[model samples]
Target: MNAPAYENGRLALMLNEPRLPTIGRFWPEFAERSDKEGWQASRLLGALLEHELAERAKRRIERHRTESHLDPTKTLATFDFGMVPMVSKAHVTALATGESWLEKGATILLFGPLRAGKSHLGSAIGHALIDAGYRVLFTRTSELVQKLQAARQSLQLPSALAKLDRFDLIILDDLSYARKDQAETSVLFELIAERYERKSLLITANQPFSGWNDVFPDPGMTVAAIDGLVHHSTIFELYVESYRRRKASDKQSAPATITMEARQL
Candidate 1:
């Protein structure tokens, strides 16, 4: 018998031919069909495996807090840099491009008044470093003192400082916000000394080095801490009106308030 007109040869002939077993029972045709389905299934499984692996990597970063040791407390969601000077999207892009924000043991000082976006800038940088697979630690100046106090009582000060090195970026937010005693100021300096050449730091304060003594309590230690940080750091001073207060005023004067929902395109 002549083969089917569309036949390429034996394989096509089998798929196209009428047979005793019927079209559904054509073994060669079914075999080829099964193979194609299997190939597709294999591809689907491979893609699933890759996705799972990526998820696991993210989880590992979350778990270690030190493996790329990023802080879980990044304030990226709270910051909106509208009219604030110093940090910008361009700065973050450069960071993501692998530029070192903290270079060669330099300190970074972000000074401004309350609600001046100081913490926001530091938090944003921390998030950026995390995305770039670098470790970051975030804490307010007061929180850091509390941690040091606890570490001291437990005789874990050195160990705690050792763990601090696990992060590539260390942010001491809200420095000079609340006043502190002598011992606390000493502890703060020690932590900085520990991180000096070993890692990077981001210090945010309401006042500059000259006014640090007002918050630090101990003049000598405060001066030393300021020296340690400023000796090798860049300082960004924000001298604008508080965005927080401005928004509050706007909301109060508005006839109605509206909340917007984020939509996927």
Candidate 2:
């Protein structure tokens, strides 16, 4: 091959070998613009590196968000703080940063009745943390427990738990659904114990600590699990009426109110 063709081949090989695909794909356009604009070498190199870094960050966040399995519609922006006056918006905003609490591997517990937005709040926090560059996994409590139990039967429980360590936070939605069985609760306890002070957990449950005995079956295991989770935890109790219930009531009343207004007219 000619000198220019050989040089181009070498450049392609170098970019591909290092897996700098973003820079490789965009650098040519950047070079064309730079030459036309009389840009210095350092300025062109800096712009390319910055663009590559930004693209990598964007891709990383998107990949993590997909793996997190968070509800796309539930976010801090969509949550109505007015309905739940007790939950401090400012406090939640701080937690979303994933700095002090997440770094210490703390737990965040959300307790409320059904349809009270516990899952949405937990998921919103998960999404925020993921945006802040933390890995998060959102899963139903029963599903994860069953998975862990199966791994235990296959004697791959340790490996399974180790795989979860990559996530900075794990959001266990609907913790009240995990069966009150020894096998199921045992694995759940093991997971809690494993992540204790090592990785964060965000759990949304219908029942409070007092009712967790219905989930653990064994008193000792219940205490142990609660102990680990509550040690370095931030707990939120949502005391508002069910969001779905309220919305349904509003819809039911709207027609009645309209009918009364029509009669008055």
Candidate 3:
């Protein structure tokens, strides 16, 4: 075969291989650059391999983010840290990196009243973790509880919980919604037990531990669940007025403020 035919054959073979698609797609352009620049063989090979590695990393991060179910709009940049002065921005920023805590399978618990941005903060951390190459899943606590209950009914509870092990962290949004149901709470406790010390959970709840009896109903279960979660956990209590209420107040004053400004003009 001629030189061109031989090169084409190699490219075709690479394209057929599962792992070489990125390299195959970009090799021709890289080869052209190599020829034009009079690059050494090692330089061309290193450049092509580096490009493939970077593209692979990007694709992996995107796939994990999609599977995470994190809200694209709720990110660290969009979170108003000033609103919740108690929750330090620097602390949150460090946690978002998923460095030591994730490796230790520690839990992150956010306690705050409704509309205080607990879910938003949890989701923002999840997004940041995903960008740092950690797998995460964000779901409403009630929804995930329902799914687990169904899995239990179908004799697939273990399987369902096992499937969740793929994620490095699971964010359970609005834990209060699943309160006072024995069946739901049972499965939730089971999940907490299963992942105890083995994986991480990020839970957002409106109620504190003192009020968890309303959620678990069974005191023993409540204590056990709390023990499992809190043993290796970081808790943040956000005592702030509701963001929705603040917005409404601002909105109500806008028209009057506009009128006053018009009078001044």
The top-ranked prediction according to lDDT is: 2
**Candidate 1 TM-score, C-alpha based:** 0.68
lDDT of 2 by residue, 1-265 (tens): 6655346558777888988888888888898899899999899999888988999999999999999999999999988787788899999999999999988999999999999989889989989999999999999999999899999999999999999999999999999888658877999999999999989999999998989888999999999999999999999999789976876787899999999999999
Clashing residue pairs in candidate 3 are none
lDDT of 1 by residue, 1-265 (tens): 9955433356446544643223323444544665677757565545545555666568666654554333445445555656575666565456543355454655677888988767666776677666666777777778888889789879999998897877777888887864777776667778888887668888888876788787777777777777777777777777678857876777786644433222321
Summarize candidate 3's per-residue lDDT along 147-215 as a digit string, tens digits: 999999999999999999999999999988887479878999999999998899999999999888887
Number of the candidate with higher TM-score, 1 or 2: 2
lDDT of each structure? 0.68, 0.91, 0.91
* Top candidate when judged by TM-score against the true structure: 3
Clashing pairs in 1: 65-69, 66-69, 68-135, 106-232, 107-232, 107-233
Each candidate structure's TM-score, on Cα atoms with residue i matched to residue i, is: 0.68, 0.89, 0.90
Ranking by TM-score: 3, 2, 1
